[model samples]
Target: MNTKQLIEEAVSLPLEERAIVVDSLLRSLNQPESEIDKQWANEAKRRLSELRSGHIEAIPGNDVFSKVWDRFEK
Candidate 1:
């Protein structure tokens, strides 16, 4: 089917199905690189290990956001 016809059919789908279709289309246009994803996963694991081991202290989200807002207001 043509683009217009395809769009009409997609629009007729149920909300959940439409979301799946949209996500599929977006993923197709922006494919993730497995190597970069793996690197990010490793970094996340390292950070979590550090936090658990007390090698680094976790900052409270409220304090972080307050500092950010304070900087912006200056």
Candidate 2:
């Protein structure tokens, strides 16, 4: 019921379950209008607009990953 009791119950959970609870609690503390989210949203819209207008072309995922793997292997 209280914060102390809730914390004690969480602590009694298995290690993996405790990690999930801690991650969920931490995520709940994040604000909706976080600065990074706004920046990323703007960037995503810009990329989408460019793609739609034929200003840029999307590369195949397999081609991109193959190039990356080749570079890393060297």
Candidate 3:
């Protein structure tokens, strides 16, 4: 049917059902990820390279948490 008819039918749906329809429509659209995704991937690669080259010290999680708690308690 026409856009107006389709919209009226959609609006008549239950709230949860309408939400599902909207979600499906959004997912069907072709969209690119945000710039932050690209930046995150690049930063992850850089960190991996640094780890491979031994450019940074790897601290244990327990030690890190201990230090955090020490400072937090003071």
Candidate 4:
């Protein structure tokens, strides 16, 4: 129904479901043609092209996360 009712219903949802609702709501607030989206799209395409052309190597997710944790974790 209205915003208040919608918010109350969303809050009553389970934690994971509430998080999905919040994420979707936040996404809706952004314009698809915004500069940020265009930049991300271009970056994604560039990464995909690089992977296909072998211009750069793709690191495993675990390796990437391990590097991040090694740098940031105490």
On TM-score, the leading prediction is 1
Q: Model 1: clashing residue pairs?
A: none
Off by over 4 Å in 1: 1-29
Q: Write the per-residue lDDT of candidate 3 for residues 1-74, one digit (tens) a residue.
A: 99999999999999999999999898679565779779999999999899889998778999999999999999
Candidate 2 per-residue C-alpha lDDT over 13-63 given as tens digits, one digit per residue, 9 for 90 to 100: 999999999888888897467788989999999999999999999999999
Steric clash pairs (candidate 2): none
Query: What is candidate 1's CA lDDT for residue 52?
Result: 100
* Model 2 TM-score, 2 decimals: 0.58
**Residue 35 error for model 1, in Å?**
1.3
| 61 Cα displacement, candidate 4 (Å) | 0.9
Question: Which window of 10 residues has the lowest lDDT sum in candidate 1?
Answer: 23-32
Model 4 accuracy (lDDT, Cα):
0.92
Candidate 2 stretches with Cα past 4 Å from truth are: 1-26, 29-33
User: For model 4, what is the alpha-carbon lDDT of residue 16?
Assistant: 100
lDDT of 1 by residue, 6-74 (tens): 999999999999999999999999999999999999999999999999999999999999999999999
The 0-to-1 C-alpha lDDT of every candidate, in the order given, reads 1.00, 0.95, 0.92, 0.92
TM-score (C-alpha) between model 3 and the true structure: 0.52
Candidate 4, residues 8-72: lDDT per residue as tens digits? Answer: 99999999999999888888997477887889999999999999999999899999999999999
Q: Give the clashing pairs for model 4.
A: none
Alpha-carbon RMSD of each model: 3.3, 6.1, 8.9, 4.3
